[model samples]
Target: MGKQVVAESARRRRRPTKQGTVLTEAHIVETALRVLREHGSAGLTARRLGAALGADPSTLYRYFAGMDELTLAIGEELIGRALSGWLPGGDWREGLRELGLRIHGAYLAHPQAAVLTASRVSGRPREIEADEAILGVLRTAGFPDRAAVRIYHAFIDQTLAFAALDAASLALGRRARESDEERWESTYAKLPADSHPHIAATAGLLSARMKDSAYPAALDMLLHSAATQLAAARAADRGASGTSAR
Candidate 1:
């Protein structure tokens, strides 16, 4: 006991003090989240987080095993934000639509973090809740359990994929966007009046809707398609089961 005490004392004397030992995983994660929002994935390093926290970078290791673990925590935080204030009451359609929009909005709000965590598969806290919420809505809306689960899968897959896709698109340089825009304006907008009547008619509407309004509209359309597909599959299942019994 005396030897252990001396060793502890010597270690304490040699060890440099961190900015604050009261620091915790939550604080680290919250700090990292802010860094991610402001500086993006490349900026979210243990060194950077520690520098922001006024501590040695190694101080982060005391809370997290490594960068991957910290990133998983960050991912959970993002998903938790998506699930916040998300009441699943009332119409199931409204519930699913709101859930999707909330998740998409949460990711879009933190595009860097969204891109970092979107490709990772971590079944953390908010991930489970989001799944339960979507599955419950699909099931209650008359989808068979299996079909409900499938639709839930598609719903989340679409949310993350589209969020990342848009973030990536926005991150591309203005030159790329300008060139793409010029191409569209020159080629599509210049379509002959009768050759591409639909494009000519709705090009203005498309241009207007592309200014962020298209996201929610696209999500609504996706949800509607999934719901319709689920309903048809459910009916076919019932019909098959009845025929077998007969």
Candidate 2:
């Protein structure tokens, strides 16, 4: 009991001293982001974070209720960083593509955090801002509210999903990428007519296109289809509303 008391006293001293100091939430979130980038998800314990700032792990509790809250803060910070300097005054396709690229870049920048937070929607202020920004752009391009929301959902989901996949792909290093490509080519070469007839014939194109060469074109086609469908839906709604108003 005496030893336990002594250890507790030492821990108290290790904690931050300013019980009443104004600890900005942004600062805590930013620190968490740095910790994630430097150490990955496995290294971001509250104790380590506090020690990095010369504070006790309890100091983090003053800002966040728990680790889940801290994860939310970091997620919003990542989204907000992607949205920095983004303005909605251009072709809708260009705007949306730029937004997706920025998001992908941000996720790649802190892959450890991205791997952890990409699966959940935080719905925090920064996340709301990102959604609004995308929806606002789509609306200004003549999409109705419902169509705007639909396109917005698809756009955001694809970007996050692709970002997560792309980040995981990159962590494999150059050797893994080449080795995987070679192995794929080997199996594709062995595809017989009895198994995958069509695949065997175009195995060369299929293999090449299945890798990096096809993603950009496929992404563009998807975006084009989404934009066209959204536009048609908006026009239909407008026509219906006009007839009803008459």
Candidate 3:
């Protein structure tokens, strides 16, 4: 604890930017996020971050050990934003549903940053709190410890995996993205029925649906499965209690 305090004190030493502004860890992280958004993932180099903050690149090392640490911090910032005003209602299924959506929305909001950080384990305070909050929702909703842990693992993994997958599509170059969109309509929709009967039969529907994300549908499936498990567990408990009474 003492070592952590000393390290944090050292990290927080205020430095002056080239633009005559003051630099803090928050400022650097925020600027890095903007850089990632505006310039794409590759643009998030130390030199670029330094230029964005109007400070030397080396100055960032004071707050972060390296680019990896900074990236983790950026990921944590996204998690923090996702949970900002979110409180779980008593309905466990709906609560998990909303939390999953909030996280997906927050990451999709910054595709480049999301692409960089979605698969990472931030292990920061916000990330830890988010995990605890989800587990708390499951436990309080009457799930046993083993079941709660299983569901919690599935919930977090599915949410983040979808976020990363969707964000990758969003992070594509403008021309590449346009090409992908065009192919769905001009190529896939126009395929000959004889050679690809199933796809051809559903081409109209598939083309219409391709533009939207699959995350919502996927999240609903997970929630439904969890609800089924909870109901089954309850039924099993009732059966056991009835037998004991007899």
C-alpha TM-scores of all predictions: 0.77, 0.74, 0.93
Name the candidate, 1 or 2, with the larger TM-score value.
1
Could you tell me which residue pairs clash in candidate 3? none
Better of 2 and 3 by lDDT: 3
lDDT at 193 for candidate 2?
79
Error of 1 at 223 (Å): 2.4
What is the lDDT of every predicted structure here?
Answer: 0.75, 0.76, 0.89
Question: Once model 3 is optimally superposed onto the true structure by TM-score, how far is the C-alpha of residue 183 displaced, in angstroms?
Answer: 1.5
Ranking by TM-score: 3, 1, 2
Worst 10 residues of 1 by lDDT: 1-10
lDDT of 3: 0.89
**Span of 10 residues, lowest total lDDT, candidate 3:** 1-10
Note the residue pairs that clash in candidate 2: 15-56, 16-56
The numbered model that scores best in TM-score is 3
Question: Clash number for model 3?
Answer: 0
lDDT of 2 by residue, 66-134 (tens): 888789888888898999998878788888888888887788787778887887888898899999888
